[model samples]
Target: MKSANDQATALLEFRLSAHRTLGPKERDLISHLSWRVEELPARQTFIHDGDKPAHSCLVLAGVVARTQYTAGGQRQILSVHIPGDMPDLQSLHIGRMDHDLETVSATQIAFIPHKDLNHLCAISQTLNATFWRESLIDAALHRAAIFRNAQLDADSRLAHFLCEMHFRHKAVGLVDEEGFSFPLSQELMGEVLGLTIVSINRSSQTLRSLDLIRMQKGHIQVLDVDGLVRFGQFDGTFLHQRFDHETLARAS
Candidate 1:
C-alpha cells in the first residue's frame, strides 16, 4: 500500500501535468478540491443509462467500457476508457447519462464530485475552457470511430483500432515505440469493433503474418510502426490535435 504522502505526491504530479495549461491560481483551485480514489472490481458498473451522474470519474488504471444496449438486447461499445481519460465529462452539461460505464478489469478511479467541479470551473475560466475542450475532443473521437466503422473493412478496422490505441497510450506516456500494455480480452475488443471474436482473432493472425504487430501475455508490440500505420490508414490528427494552439502554446 502506498502511504498518504506518496499518494498525495502522485496526485499532485498528475494534476500538474494534466492541467499544465492552466494558470497557477487555476491549478491551486484544482488542488484544493477533494478527490476520492476508489477501486472497482472487474465487470462492475460505475454508471448506467438514465442515471444522474453524481461525480466525474478519472481512470487511474485498468480499462472501462462505455456500452449501450439496443432494443434487441445487443450491446454496442461506444468507447473504451483508459488511463488519463475523463470518462464522465458529459455529465458536466447533461443531466443524466445515456450509456453504461463499466470496468473491464479491476480498476482504480478518482472521483470528483460534480458540485465541487462546477465550483472549481466557475472560479477558473481556464478550467472551464479546458473542460469544454476535452469534451469537444471526445466528440471528435466518436465521430472518427463512426466513420472508421462505416468505411473500413474488418481487417482494416482492427488495424485502425490498434493504431489508435498505440497513439492514445503514447499520449498518456504509457507506450514505447513498439507498443504498450494491452490487457483487454479479444471478446471486449470485438465489442468495440463490432466484430465477432473469431473474426478478430483471424485478423490478429493476419496482422502477425504481415509482421506488423505481435501480442503475447496481454502485451502488444508494434513490430513496424510505419507499416502498421499504413495498413490501418490511420490519421494521427484526430488524436494529436485535441488541444487548441493557444492552450498547447501555453502548456509548452
Candidate 2:
C-alpha cells in the first residue's frame, strides 16, 4: 500500500509534469502545500465579476469558463480552462477580479490560498519560474485571441481555436489523435468566437464535411491533422514549450 506521503508525491508529480522545466525542489514545495479539493457543479460560479478573489484554484478535472458580463446583462465567454490550469492567478496579485470563472461541467479544483502561493514562491525559485511561465502563457493566449479577432474570419477563428485547444491538450497529456473531451456547448463556443450559434454550427458542419474534424457527443477528432493545420493557419510557437530545444534557442 502506498503511504500517504508517497501518494501525495505522486499527485504532485502528475500535476507538475506539464511544467517541463520544473525540478525536484519545486515539486517538493508543491507537495508540501495543503490543497483543498472542491467539486464544482456544472454552470456553477467560482469567481464573480467585481468580487474580491480569495484563493487561486488549480483545476484537477473538468472544464471552467472565464466569462464577462455586459452592462445590459449579456455574457461573453472569454476562455475555457482545462486540467492543470490555474485560471485566476492574475486576480491574486491584482487584488480584484474583472471577470467571472464558472464551471461548465462537474469539475474538481485544488484551492490554494494566495498568501500560501506567495510564500511558496519566496522559498522556491523553481516554483517562481513555473508560475512566471504560466502567466506568460496566459498572456500569450490573450494576445493570440486579440490578433485572431482582428485578422481571421469566423470560420478561420473557429478552426484556429480548435487547433489551439487540441495542441494544448496534447501538451498536457490529455489528448490523442481523437481530440480530448471538450465540455463546451455550441453557445459557449459561439461566445468565445464572437459568433452566433447558427454560425458556429455552420462552421462545425463545414469542417466535418471537409473531413478535417469529426465531433461525436462531446469528443472531437482531428481526422486530417495536416488539413486542419492548413485550414486554421496554426503555428505551434505560441504554446511556449519550455523543454523544446528550438524554443530554448529562440529564447537565448
Candidate 3:
C-alpha cells in the first residue's frame, strides 16, 4: 500500500510513460504533483466523451481504455492503457474528451488537476518532455488501432492486441512466465478487434488450438512467441517504447 499523497505510483507511471529514463531531478517532480486515488469499478466511465475535465486520470493499477460509441450505441475501444499510464492526458489541451475513458478492470486511479500538472511541467524541463512524450505515444497507439481495424483480419487483430498487452505489461515490470493480468472481457475484446464477442472467443480458441496461446483464469500465456508474432503480423514498432527492448534485455 502507498501513502495517501500518491508519490510512488505517480512516479512509476511517469518513468515507464516514456522511452527516456527519469533522473533524480526529474523524479523530484513527483513530490510536486497533487492527486487523490479513486477506486472505480469495471465499466464505469470516469471521463465521458464530450465533457471537459478539470483533472487528468492516471492508471496506477488495473487496465483502462479510451472508448467511443457509434450512433447505434455500439462501443469501440481505441486503446488499452495499463498501469503507469495517464489515459486522459490530452484533455489538458483538448479540454473536452473526444472519447470515453472507462475501467476495464476494477481500477485504482490518481486524478491530478491540470493546474497542478502544468505548474510542475513549467518548472521542470525534463518533466515537461516526459509528459509530452507520453502524449505522443497516445497518438501513435490510436493510429495503430485505426489501422488495425481498417486493414487487419480477425486473427491478426487479436494477436496484435495480445502482443501489445504483453509488451505494455513488460514495460512496468508486470510480467512473469505464467503471464500478466488480463482483466479484459470477451465483450471488450470484441470492441477492440471489431468482432462479435463470439468471434473473439473463436479467435482465441483457434490461437490455442494452434499452440500460440493459452488464456485461463483472466491471464493469457503465449505458448509460442514466433508463431504468434507471425500470425498477428505484429511488428510492435508502433508502440514507440524503445526502452522496451532494454527492459527485455534486463529481464533476459
Candidate 4:
C-alpha cells in the first residue's frame, strides 16, 4: 500500500517539473489536497459510462484504461492512465462520464471530492491554472494517439506506442535498469492500438528482429534507443514532458 507521502510524491510528478523540486505555493496546494484512498483488484471498473461521479480518481499505482463499447458490446480501450494521472480530471467540469474507467492491474487510487477541488480552485488562481493546464495536456495526448493510429502502419504504430509509454513511465520515475514496467497484455494493447492480436504478435516480432526491444514477461526492455526512435518516427514533443527527449530515451 502507498502511504500519504507516496501519494503526494506521485501527485507532484504530474507534469510539474522534470527534476526540480516544487515551489512553496505548489507544495501548499499539494498539502491541501484531500483524498480517500482505495485499492482495487486487477480489471475492476472504477467509473462506468454515464455515471455522474462526485470525485475524480488519481492513480497512485498501476494503470487505468478509458474504454468505450459498441452496441454489440465490442470494447475499445480509448487510452491508458499511469501513476500520477487523474483520468477523470475533466469530470470536474463535465458532469457525466462518456466512457468507462477501469483498473488495468491491481491499482491504488486517491479519490478527491469535487467539492474539495472546487473549493481549492476558487481559493487559488494558481491551482485553477494548474488544473486547466493538465486538461490541455490531456487533450494533446489524445491528439497524439489519434495521429499514431491514423497515420502509422502496424509495426511503426506499435513502436510509437512503446516509445510513448517509455517516456511516460520515465516522466514519473518508473523506468529502471531493466526498463519500465508494462502490465497491459497484448490483447489490451491491441484494443488500445486498434490492431488485431495477430498483428500485435507480428509487430512485436518485427521489433525484436530489428533489435529494438526485448520483452520478458510483462516488462519491455528498449534496446538501441536511437534505432527504436527512428523506426517509430516518435516525437516526444506532443507529450509535453519536462524532461529532454534524449534524457528520456536512454535507459538507466
* Candidate that would win on lDDT: 4
> Where in model 3 is the C-alpha error above 4 Å?
4-18, 245-252
Tens digit per residue, CA lDDT, model 2, 186-226: 87899888889899899999899999898767788888777
- Report model 2's TM-score to 2 decimal places: 0.89
Off by over 4 Å in 1: 1-20, 241-252
**Model 1 weakest lDDT span, ten residues long:** 243-252
Model 4: per-residue Cα lDDT over 51-104, one tens digit each: 999998788788999999999988899889997788999999999999999999
RMSD of each: 4.0, 4.8, 2.8, 3.4
Let me know the TM-score candidate 1 reaches against the reference structure. Answer: 0.88
Q: Give candidate 2 misplaced runs (Cα > 4 Å).
A: 1-17, 243-252
| Residue 109's lDDT in candidate 3 | 86
List candidate 4 segments past 4 Å from native.
13-22, 244-252
Between prediction 2 and prediction 4, which has the larger TM-score?
4
